[model samples]
Target chain A: MSSTTTTRPNGLALFILPSALMFALFFFLPIGLMALMSVLTGNPVVMPKVAFTTRHYARMVGDPYYLEVIWTTIRIGLVTTLVALAIGYPLAHWMARIKSRAGHALLLMAVLAPMLTGIVVRTFAWMTLLSDKGVVNQTLMSLGLISQPLKLMYTETGIVVGLVHIYVPFMVLTLTGVIGRIDERLEQAAENLGASPLRAFLEVTLPLSLPGILAGSLLVFALAISAYVTPILLGGFQIMTLPILIYQQISANFNVGFAAALGIVLLVISLMLVIAYNRALGLVSGQRELQ
Target chain B: MSASIEIAGVSKVYDGGVRAVDAVAMDIRQGEFFSLLGPSGCGKTTTLRMIAGFETPSSGAIRVDGADITHVPAHKRDMGMVFQNYALFPHRTVAENVAFGLRMRGLDKATITAKVKAALAMVELSGLEDRRPAQLSGGQQQRVALARAIVIAPRVLLCDEPLGALDKKLRQQMQFELKQLQKKLGLTLVFVTHDQEEALAMSDRIAVMNGGRVEQVGTPTEIYNQPTTRFVADFIGDTNIFRGERTTTSTVASALDVGKGLILALPPTEGQGTGVLSVALRPEKIRLITRTDAATAAGSSAHGIVENTNFLGGAVLYRVTLESAHRVLVQQPNAGTSRLFVPGDGVTLEWTPADLVVLKD
Candidate 1:
């Protein structure tokens, strides 16, 4: 080999260099810009010059509109997470327990079909089923359960319902991976120790799958808090969230700096919540043996 | 709790029309360390699972402690099990894993803690209470599995090749440990394994299974030395079998005519035809004799050439091929330093009729 060619980078560096450069450009640069903008808080009309200030952060803390939106986001995220878990745990258990290849294939199709379909298509399908003239309302009315068609769309209920539908597959797939790795013998061991079926589930299966639960909740909660499309389609005009407000600030008002500030605030808060969750759960924490 | 397992003509058929376990019937005594020994797909594991109440028998009934528990679910059977993979909950600490059964049974926190400590100490893992299963080595994990199973003080203990996953040395150690634990606790243990040495070492009584059926049930020595069938003789250990026909009292006459070439002589057995007998002789039971010794005719003998010689630590195995090209193996324990024979040497293999075991074809 030539001297120049022989002096080239090692194999690992050649592989890692390209992805590392791309990550720095697309990820760290935007994060840097957002961080700088969060500190810059001048109304462009009053001061055209780019100046740094903390007024936006102060306003974010003091204003009831921003506080209300944050609280609403948290509430929706928490409820959506809990509801997704309640439904996904059993479904995931059923999927993992199937012994036949065909049964497993059918289950995988059930979970993956909706996941692979377009998100807008799924939301639109739910829209037809949940509308005032939807099948659900018509069935209830014909069954004499209601005098009139109940308004099932354009409310917090609709938002949560849509979010849960969109997020439950995430929980189920995560749980399937975790539950499948668990040796079924532990559950059998529990059963043989005088635990009833329900007791074994509660004590063995549920607790053992907690890592999946934690991961799925973190993912759903993070996604729910920043959800823009579902709330816009289902929550109508009343439920204003941080993402919606940020979108309005940027697109309608053409306030790039303000939008960046809001984005930074949301990002910081979400990261803090993730860190707190990890700490409380006593995650790996550099403790390799515990893992 | 003391319990005896009586499987009355049990059979298990899967949905796809596969018979996993055929009609299997056996009685396991209370507090006995019984083994279901067989090759894979021979229904050993299925039988173990059926006795543990994990799998329901399709046709017959399973009575535990003389009570029919065939239809009862696994959890209500009140047995305890250790698996080959040592299924300790990875998320729980060792103490928590041991205390799981007590907590499920509604024991108080103090009692659970005390029992957990005792159980952990029993497996010699006293200080590993705070460690997760992933933190422990494979052997330690197996001990934790053992502690978890015993902490429940179960009615019966089921071990499905509990030592199969361990290394050879560790497996030997754990085998002794498990046997000692069984004796100390006086607990009924239903073990499953395909290792013959393991089965011979740890079992109080062994049920040799094949093709989803029990071939024989006996102690280790009986299974090895008194095999009733050809399959049993070949499976338990090495043996040299020859085809013969009983000619007189305690003598099996062979087709090979040496005027003195007798296949074997044994006690009379049950069979109708021309006394077609399958005679098995252990390798070490046959002796190598010199030409002068064979000429004297002091013992029943066969003439053959030493085809091969293997020096194994304190024993030597000589493969003797007769003029008929029939090979017989003779193993002799070496009390001195040198071997008595070499390859290509002519010798007479000698053994008395008493050493032969007559097997049904």
Candidate 2:
């Protein structure tokens, strides 16, 4: 009996031990070390001694530049989430209901083409399009809709557009997954129950697709809050966010202690937002079951 | 509370070169529980959808309450429909589901609540208004679907096999309940079902559809007792078919070409002797009697050897092989202590000529 029980746990260990080891090595250990470093105010290069101090956190809260960066990060996340949802819902609805296989394939290709392309390549393409002498400015100028080159590049508008382009696919994919699972007969039943098409959409389709909207919004918001590339390329030091600030503090200033404190603050806020979002949607229990 | 529906020359040719519903016309009178009964892939469902304005008829018109509603959208048609799977919105409470249509019509909050309560009560689900569809059992969800349809007081109600998902006993109960509700509400109902027994038991008039066309339309008794075509006779019930020639309007001399062959005298018919004719006798109509010879039995009697006997609790069913090698199904009620025939027992099958129905091939 002891031998059999030992073999059974060995079989269990074979399946679970790999992931447990990986989590400890790649996730929990690093997070623990990082959190420990957040409190130490000494040089990180050699035997950094632990010293309890909230000075870095206090400095972050008091500095106008850091506060502005935090506000800008949250604002960009909100704007990107809202824009992606607005475009994703209708596109996902169309994909879910169109009966023709060929049409569905075409729509799928359209969504996948941009997503499958590397993020850097897509961002480069957007940069060109938003450039002063690029297609957008030239077209607008030829159409008499704008004066020469209108200074559209390296602005918050450019950053938001690029962010929306990158995150729209995520929102679309999530919404499509949810909307596809909805039984279409409910919409037909709503119509037969004397609801107009618009009313039926509002009362039935919209409410049923809420889970998709919430999930997509959370995903896009998280990605947008942590974004580094698009904002750096487009904001051009004008729109400073926490990631850029953290990178400068660590790499340029070599202020690892201050950077670690800022990193801990950002990580805590992101984790809290994720937890609150899941709780509000009642999706935490569902996600746990899936895990 | 009820409205008549008229479908004229309705047809649906799908994009895949299939005529889902051929040109068909039907009129459902107010307060009538009409059923479209057919096998799968038949046009019954398509016809029902056309009436509900879900599918636009390819070449014809649909009118509800004397208005041409062929061009109107489904929601504007003022009709109610129940799906086979009971398409209740899973995200909403029962009251919210029932009140959706009322809210769409811009009804006030008080009126909506009162009507929602009344509709829930109608389906015997008054206390379940706070429950979501997923929380209810299959039967309760179907009732909620029914209430959601009727809450708006639509002129017509269309049901596409609403009880198709339930077990046999539950289906039977729902059949009775739905029929009772239809009668009680005086609502014109166009129900679609493939189960012949369900059509027979509930419909005021049954339209038996086949391959995108209506084959026959009649009361249950007429459809059972006097099916005009071979398809109708074969589809409705079990019967013994004997091929024959019509000697007259009511008499058919057997085509078996034997001197002592079967002959049937059927009820009167206006049209006769136009084609190959056959007599269909119900299994229960044939009686088994023991006699010294087949000639001693009353009415038309045939001699045969019992091939198999099945005791079905209430009745004894026997498969009898005639001398011509044609097997006839005969059923006899089991009453009192009696001699039950074994497989090899010689028997005489007797039935009155009036029990037979002559069908045109």
Candidate 3:
């Protein structure tokens, strides 16, 4: 309604203004404060920062227990990524090949329905499924496959299963977005060029879908590595990961500086893995020049 | 080796009870450059796909080289197809794309390399083997697709509007090259195209289709000049259709008494007297003469005035309003010796009975 406003050349900039402000306020501000807290002395959340110290970083490097926790955290992320990929690729490919729109929509709903539920509720559902007296062990026992009840809860396996249940939707969504866009004629062309159906998939569809795999795996890995609630509830003090250790420092010990330092370390590790994975994919994918 | 293909009454029906292809049969000889030409959704591409084993006929069969291949999977059928979009492997290098078929067959490394090199050379894309498909222009991508398909040396090659994406000049060039390649290899090539001119220019025989049915199958000359159906006549090129009831005019000649006081003389070869006769007259077949000289004309003649004149680079088309008020189109070559008639010039239209093709309407 103003003359100058109507005459402004960057009319499109108004659309991004709100999201840009929110991102700067909610994302960049928190990360900046966390980085600052990692360096400040004492409990910075409740009390004013008095002095700066490198003691938290020194303590983390000096402690072998912290390093092991980071390594285990990375291992869980890698395993979750691989498992999600294994499950998601087939589902994604099936969704891509489905001829009917209703079938595609139904399958998409089934894949994405779990993520619509709360993470805590999903973790609880997995707990009931994986408990020793749960339906899984009951069914296996009824089938006479296992004479003794397997210890399914409070272990790395239980934690991983819960993490995958919560994060696999992201993988499927990413993969489907990509694989669905690939031209079907390419595979038909491969088959036309004397490739069997399986050979056509391996030679044409697989390499073309590699970028999707990388993107989906990276998304799942980031979420899996940073996850705290599911690991805490499922692993039940038996499994040690960076998020669990950071939670304990903040909730039980009230060590804000140490908690912030651990959070920064975790963020750095995730960033490093993302960069390394991207580099590895660049070598395999002809320098990431996708159309 | 080239192979003959026999489509024995093949039909494809969809879930909605729509027949994409309806009982189409054709005997394609070995080493023939055959084309299925039609408008969109006329079953041309579907027929080609059925021959390539990409689609299954609902109630009929297809054979390749006298062996039934209707139930065979596409990979085992030994046919190479060039898709409209080129469909090159975006991730692979040009050389790798060309070598894919050879690798699938488990050929020796040296032989695959040699064949890939030869195929690239054939398409005039020898030096761009290391470049990815995204790095090349559309014409270059088309060449890559051609090289990839032909390097396999399959029994037959299928092209589904392959050059539809290219510009006009490039499409003509590729059309010439593809025809030459088909001849050089002596391979059976089934081409599907909606472009009638492209089909006429490249195909040894063209099967014109409309509404899920084949209207006619013949050489380019026959399809153009002697169209059997009204659809074929109208679809292939521009034509003036004259429809009227049969009447014997004074026992000397049988003439079709069209509306508006126009009578089209029937050829002597048309013996069967029909209830209603329909004929297609090409625009180029009619001659334009000044009304003062109209008395010297032969065959069916009419007096008209030029209503409009269209100047093409190599030809002139005149839309003449006849004495009966029926509009007739006449095209003449701009050979620079004959006077080009302008609009409002009085003219006489002349055409022999032989120029009128009786339509199976």
Best by lDDT: 3
Candidate 3 structure quality by residue, lDDT tens digits, A74-189: 99998988998998899989988899889999998999788788999989888888888988899999999999878888888888899888887888888888888889999998
C-alpha lDDT values of all predictions: 0.82, 0.83, 0.89
Instruction: Name the better of 2 and 3 by TM-score.
Output: 3
Candidate scoring better on DockQ of 1 and 2: 1
Rank candidates, DockQ, best first.
3, 1, 2
Q: Residue A63 deviation, candidate 1, in Å?
A: 2.8
Give candidate 1 misplaced runs (Cα > 4 Å).
A1-9, A41-48, A283-291, B108-131, B134-140, B243-277, B290-300, B337-340
TM-scores, all models, native as reference: 0.89, 0.90, 0.94
Best by DockQ: 3
Ten-residue region with minimum lDDT total, candidate 2 chain B: B250-259
List fnat, each candidate: 0.75, 0.77, 0.81
TM-score of chain A as modeled in candidate 1: 0.89
For all predictions in the order shown, the interface RMSD in Å is 2.8, 4.6, 1.7
Sorted on lDDT, best first, the list reads 3, 2, 1
Badly placed stretches (over 4 Å) of model 3 are A1-17, A44-49, A286-291, B293-299
**DockQ, Cα level, model 1:** 0.47
By DockQ thresholds, what CAPRI class is model 1? Answer: acceptable
